[model samples]
Target: MKKIKTSPLLPQEFVVENISENEANIIAYPFEVGYAVSLAHPLRRFLLSSSQGYAPVAIKVEGAKHEFDSIRGMLEDISEFIINLKSIRFKLKNDETDAEVTYTFTGPKEIKGSDLSNEQVEIVTPDAFLATLNEDATLTFTLKIYQGIGFVPSEDIRDELDDGFIPLDAYFTPVRKATYEIDNVLVEDNPNFEKVIMNIVTDGQIGPVDAFKNALEVMYAQMAVFNSEISVAAPTTVERVDETPEIKKLMGRIEDLGLSARSFNCLDRSAVKFIGEIVMMSEADLKNVKNLGKKSYEEIVDKVAEYGFAVGADLSDEVVSAVKKKIEAE
Candidate 1:
């Protein structure tokens, strides 16, 4: 009969491959079964819905009272012109609040994003077409550029609009696309581990690598809401003193403990590098470390006991007594 392996493993590495300035592939490997999908789905949602960007939320065209109206000499009607405005991406240079941008063009000529005059805003898609005008005809318009996240319908901001301002559906997320795929990967002799391959594409306003990082940050912030302190009915507290001689000896490097790879990595990643630190942590605290399972926790407890120290024990008197006895024998 074959034995079953029950412990979980942390991903070995997270690598970002920049495919282009605005596209990237993020890879993480050696996750336990089903963990890849658990991580990738939420990240995909956050990347698509939480990224911030600027878009024209409202517009007022000269010679046009509403979207249904038409402007003379303009090749595109008011509705078509507004749709073109949605394609022009804006990047704010500073912390300025939302503001109105105006453009005036005379034809015979073609109008583009370059025709807009705004020092605080940069047109990322400057070559984007707006409309064309006939000879001696003039086109004028004002756009209310607003910074926001995800897709917001015009009706959501309708109450905030003033008279004659045509509300628009805003596409504010800079992430153009986000997707992920999972594949079976081998870890040691186990064939059930998985890997995640995520592809991200962003608009010119943000880089793909930056968008990936921001999505991770968003996921972290959302998870932090549930990272509250775990309360126990009777908590075991181990006070540590750095000045005592035996305690100082206990502060020796954790590497000397000869812990298993999984146990040692869990402690190292948790920043518990000293034997003193490990001795001070309760079983519950050790269990809280990412990927530290019950088996690894038991291994840590047994290894620490070999040194005549107990995890989460009141070591003030017991440690001093053990050190003195060992010194006398030496």
Candidate 2:
């Protein structure tokens, strides 16, 4: 009988080695022989079907009552015009779930995506062709833009639209393509490890790396549902002491410490108002505060130590909450 060697169930590292405007190549290594395929397949599916994007859900074109109607002066019939509208990529700049865009043209001129105007939505494919008009022809249209995920058939929105509005089949995924390849790799004298290489492409509305990350988040959300009922008790290493009085003293206003203007302003801008918040924060967390340089961080640490407390002190949640409530009452 042959025995299998022990290997890591999860990949050791995931790195994006190659990236461009709308495409990215990500590689994950040292996954157990079959784990690479297991992880990559679901991620690719999520990237294609779960990523959010914006598309035109319905449109009202002047001189055409329905999708099959023909309009004079336009090179493309109404149906062809609808197809062109489907290819235009968009992104919502605000929190709006939907928006309206209007375009009007009088030509012998070519109609492009840039002609559609909406303040809340950004047209990602400004150069995309929509239609052409002959001399002395007029074109005017209004599009109902919607933010959604996956494919939404026209019939789903047809009954909701008012008269003269033609509903469109919306493909709202920003990921244009997603694929993965798995290959065997050597790890720790073992040759059975697998490496996964994922290639992702997105419409200009979203970057490929962002799309890949969104897919990973969606996958995590789906898997987390199974773990909802499996809560495990956290082990306690030491008994906690009552230090509510000491913590309350530390919870006083930060201005009482007399820190320099630069350090004080930086802490204020970061929304840190009390000395206890600063004392509990680690050096790494302090470094992340905007405009707080090395000198300011060192000064803060020294200042806290002068008060008989050090940064990164671990206080029990009950003590911290009590101190906060006492300070608030004052």
Candidate 3:
């Protein structure tokens, strides 16, 4: 550590290799140039440094523990992770060009709390309007992901988040966003759920299930087999799952058309089944699928009621407007 005196009381400790005045100022204070990652609480953050250009910079920070014994316990907990580390390579990033490292520390937050009632009831209704669309038309959509639902890399944390109000305080920002994309939208026909493919969008928006179902209209068609020169089977038989054995058998007879049986709850009925909870299926797909009947939906509600759950639906008004605009543009 090189001590450079900028002022009588403004001395700064800098890493060995880079003795630049800027680097000195950056590493001063309770921390050195690099960040320290201590698993313990009452966070004593560490400074990080990578003498070697292409290595991970090891962090040195204080342990979090209310008591001295607890501090020791925390040390023991992290001993394995820090044991072999003599120095970590400080890269511009985990794998990027060199840049100034910036960070801010937040204090032990009482973290605001909220009251939620799991005992509440929710009402959902099926989307008959969405179901009315042509089930045979292949619905192709370039889903515009709704806001507030994408993978925001962790290092993107704001430099002023914590403001480091409390001296020597440290924190670990939990990766908030899920790595997986929103509940998988049935962009393509999946074999398992063949008869009717459901391409539902669940991420980006949050709210009731029925509302969610109403917003999406995914077109589904069966796999078409080309007979080299011959055309396809009757388009009428495509994607429509038949309940009767005769209709189902007839679908198989249609060349290039693979009509298979599929079981699904009716639109309004099923929609009413999950009024409050978040459901992801688009309204059009639910209505297109056979068996989604008022009767079946009622049965679903009754069965669901038996488990002490309420029905519900949801869709974002903004999403509805946006989709409408998209259709207008088309």
Candidate 4:
């Protein structure tokens, strides 16, 4: 299996199997998935290679809690930045005393030099930017996302607690730096017909297109009921019908292939009870499997809940009873 990290909200039975490297299909993929596949674009080359630009992020700097009554704070002063695509700001509050203060969402530039007057060129190459940080302080910085399709949704994916994204630890595998041979090709012969393709072999969530569409429907419904600020609006249409957009699937050239498979209630014994598997197969595996169809994919995928949990197998008697009670309480 090509190890790709799972999302925290990822369902249980996802795995990757036989794969091929080939062409891209121009389907209306989700925003997050689209962004991931867009990395093959030529535009990214400039962003990744650029030595002058900097990305901005906001963070907190809570000074030593032990020594000072007041904590000092500051906006990560990337005052010398070149590509000010965005800016992060801050305010200070005190004197420092604790062994070390913890900060969230901060960058090396955000830490104030102890002397407060230390002269440092805030804008430097990505390498230099990393080297300037004080070793003693806790830090967090903006991640450089390699987005293939830029859908800068101004929100983090929500979790059950509404606290934030699923922690990386929960994902079964980590994402690898998957590469694409051809990212963009013209969908139509028109001079301006543009199509971008990203090749990724997902640890697919089980279900058919119908299942996915249905799950999406319910997920969107709940999001609206709860008035979530970061929820995705219900898609007007998520079908592969005659009137659907003309997105084409282009096969890969080499050994890379893309085939999706999902199996439910497959396990005989399990701890949490629910068991299943969703696998992305290679061209070879795809050909050997019989009755692999779009409807099947939808059926499997539609079973995934917004909690990123999948419904399958059988719950333990105790577990089911507890779940029933929980639902009743809700």
Candidate 5:
């Protein structure tokens, strides 16, 4: 069998080649075709179904019913107009709670998405068709746009929504394109394969880097749920598990201490394992950590006290004596 060589995946595997206003191109090298293919679907689905975007979800129409009335622009019933509204991309300029815009049209001409613009809302897909009208047709209505992840059906909309607004089926996904390619495949006569390249393209709302970050966060959150249920003996190389009541009381992530990411990132592994060390560390000792400053140190002090833990508080003397005796016996 002939031998084939492939580049090993290193730190610089993922590279962004180009970025545009609404799109980005990225390449991940030294990837296997099987893993790349597996990653492609979830990434694409997450980009298209999970990413947040804007869409018009409600509309109140005037002078229209099941059948076209005497009005000229009432080419279709209210149902058709609602369908068209769902397709229009609406960008909410105001807070999500306050998402209402009024569009009044005395249609002497064709009505389009662009004509629905208000100070609080702008139609992104401006060329979208609404309805055609003759000289005397008139239509006036208010639209409510919402920001949410994934597609939510009209019936699922809660009763708390304001009266006169009906939820419509809308897909607010901003991802216009999501595709992956596997390239640079090399095979030997014996069917041994070498390297493969995978490329990803994403819409501008989120670049490839942020998209991957979001996807990873989603994946990590999912794994965290299942990780608690797994039961097995860990290898001996793992750190000794602390089973004492005092140690159990200290268990938690750094965020449990109320420190933000900026300050938490500066803490070493040892300090994180013994969270009380955060309060025990002196100003001079903490200042030595990269990027940790007086302001953050003060914040940590205040937050620790809020949690009823004092700065520099140590283990009880009785506990220490018990530990000393146990160690001496050992």
Candidate 6:
């Protein structure tokens, strides 16, 4: 007879396996990663659409007619240069006015992002070319660099004056890239048990751990307000109720009510014994008894509603009116 080797069971947790340069791989054991995966989308969106950076917001030029030779090409070159600038992250040393800096560029060469740098601002991508000149062109112009979130137009940030203000849209997105992947790794001697690998990547500004933390913070904040709102709409009182064994069995198992695993687990053991009173209490009041969040309360409401009852259905018109009036007075 051959003996089977027993392996130690791994606890559910998150572990960073590798981090190289700008990317990192992490492992989360026995996690219902759908929750984490759902959060990843918002993290990426926040990184790309909400992160802060600096860019050129305004520009001015002189010493050339509207239709000078190769002026169109020069404008196109500048456009491409600005597009590249949008990708670079800038570090601001001191607060500066939105006031523009006047510079004379007699360019017979390529003008780059570094050329715009001053003592207060340092350009990370100095090699980026803003414009190229085939012939000598004298251009005296002001560059207005400012810090902001997302792509903000000059009109939205400052007064719209027709003072030769070339309104340029500024890009401040600091996130260069973000991606995540889920993989299943078989545990030793336990082919049936697997660990979930959640790999994440981001720009140097924000690391994977920080991003995940922020995402959870946002989700919890929203859930807190949402839970409060739905609870106030329905209030319940705790009272004894007589029920037949059949009715008790029908509501015995929280899972039988089509509640999610996460929400079902949040219910206290006492909840099973008080199912009758529970279904009659407002969801807001349930927070006083059951240790659950907004999602759990919502699930309970859905389950109760299916049986033609509500969390606060037992409240009389007089009680409901009083509660409403009290709430308004507050």
Best-performing candidate as measured by lDDT: 2
Give the CA lDDT, 0 to 100, for residue 268 in model 6.
45
Residue 239 shift from truth in candidate 1, angstroms:
28
Tens digits of lDDT, candidate 1, 58-93: 988888888989988888899898888888888777
Which candidate model has the greater TM-score, 2 or 4?
Answer: 2
lDDT of 2 by residue, 1-330 (tens): 545537344454567855789988989777876888988999999999999999999999888989999778999999999888887898877777788777788889998877664677787889999999999789898888888999999999999998989999999999899999998987544688899999998888789888888998999788776677987454333222344568757866778788999999999999888888887788789889999999999888888888777888887787667656544432
Q: What do the candidate models score in CA lDDT, each in turn?
A: 0.80, 0.83, 0.23, 0.26, 0.59, 0.55
Which 10 consecutive residues of model 5 have the lowest summed lDDT? 187-196
Q: How large an RMSD does model 1 have?
A: 12.7
Better of 1 and 4 by TM-score: 1
Work out how many backbone clashes candidate 4 has: 45
lDDT, model 5:
0.59
Model 5, 1-330: lDDT tens digits are 523547322211455655564556655544444555566567666766766677766656665432223344567567777766666677676555347677777757778878877787766678888877667778777766777777877667646467656566766666666676655543211222223332344433345556656766766566576568886454233122334765444333356776776677667432443345554556567667777778877776787777656556676765444444332221
TM-score for each predicted model, relative to the true structure = 0.67, 0.67, 0.16, 0.18, 0.55, 0.49
Residue 43 lDDT (model 3): 15
In candidate 4, where is summed lDDT lowest over 10 consecutive residues?
Answer: 246-255
lDDT for each residue of candidate 4 in 205-312, tens digit (9 for 90 to 100): 111222223334544454586555666555443222221111111111111122122322221111112211222223344223355455544444453332233334
Q: List runs of model 1 lying over 4 Å from the truth.
A: 1-7, 229-330
Error of 1 at 267 (Å): 27
- Candidate 1 TM-score, true structure as reference: 0.67
Q: Write the per-residue lDDT of candidate 6 for residues 60-82, one digit (tens) a residue.
A: 55533222222433554344544
What's the lDDT of the predicted structure labeled candidate 6? 0.55
Candidate number with the higher lDDT (1 or 6): 1
